[model samples]
Target: EPEVTQTPSHQVTQMGQEVILRCVPISNHLYFYWYRQILGQKVEFLVSFYNNEISEKSEIFDDQFSVERPDGSNFTLKIRSTKLEDSAMYFCASGDTSGTSTDTQYFGPGTRLTVL
Candidate 1:
């Protein structure tokens, strides 16, 4: 069961410009995540990478937000400028779940950011 894949599933920027949302996690999963769900609320957490750097991030991942893997498969999310509450549905996740709870966190099939 291999999942986690996202692309231009839906994106309609305009509020400030800049937008780059893409994902392809689940190939062995080494811990990776970026979530958003500002439509009806819930699901927040903004960033978390591994091995390459940035092991954790939150507070909406300020500084305009940015995450990258750019290789070994692909994983990116950059919104340098975009407002209108940043409209959301973005989600990309992978997991090792070493902390327990069984281990599973594969999500992807989201990229509905419409800020205008």
Candidate 2:
């Protein structure tokens, strides 16, 4: 079965530097989302995109963050300036297209971003 894939698996960056996290969502999926968990914190939604535009975004998705579908198969999230608090496990997820209320999201293993 096809699955979402995220690259690097881990990233280390200096504060104020930019970082781009990559993901390839499952084919035939209609919705994509980005969520982050700050170590022991709960997973918080960052943004959700569908039909080529942002469907929803949380307060955490501030001026420093942006997302795009750079190609038919690749989705990317860019952080304009990293901060020490920005370190977290960023997860890329895809929604099921089966039209079921229980259509759960499938998550990538995650890319652990570490800012110094």
Candidate 3:
């Protein structure tokens, strides 16, 4: 019955500002990931983290974006410099710790980021 928790339900930032969104996923999950959906656009994968390091990343996860698990219980996504195009709903997700890729990913409600 556990689920992901994201802080600052919504964020408003000016272009070029830095933003960090936080999340706390299901306790027993081992893999974490970040995804985003631009308003009216398709959802896109940003990055995947496991064992405290990045396991995989998509082209959208460029130098401008980064993720970390500063504390075992919290997962965070940081956008070094916000862009208008970066405005989107960012979701946090986690998968089972079964050590198999087949496990399903459970997603958080998401943090809506708005950029001017």
The total of clashing pairs for model 3 equals 0
lDDT of each: 0.87, 0.93, 0.94
Q: Relative to the unseen true structure, what is the Cα RMSD of model 3?
A: 0.8
Which pairs, if any, clash in model 1?
A: none
TM-score each candidate.
0.31, 0.94, 0.97
CA-only RMSD, every prediction: 12.2, 1.4, 0.8
- Candidate 2 deviant stretches above 4 angstroms: 98-102
Which is better, 1 or 2, measured by TM-score? 2
> How big is the positional error of residue 73 in model 2, measured in Å on the Cα after superposition?
0.6
Question: Any idea what lDDT model 3 has?
Answer: 0.94
Query: What residue runs in model 3 are displaced by over 4 Å at the alpha carbon?
Result: none
Candidate 1 off by > 4 Å? 5-32, 35-46, 49-55, 58-60, 63-82, 85-89, 97-107
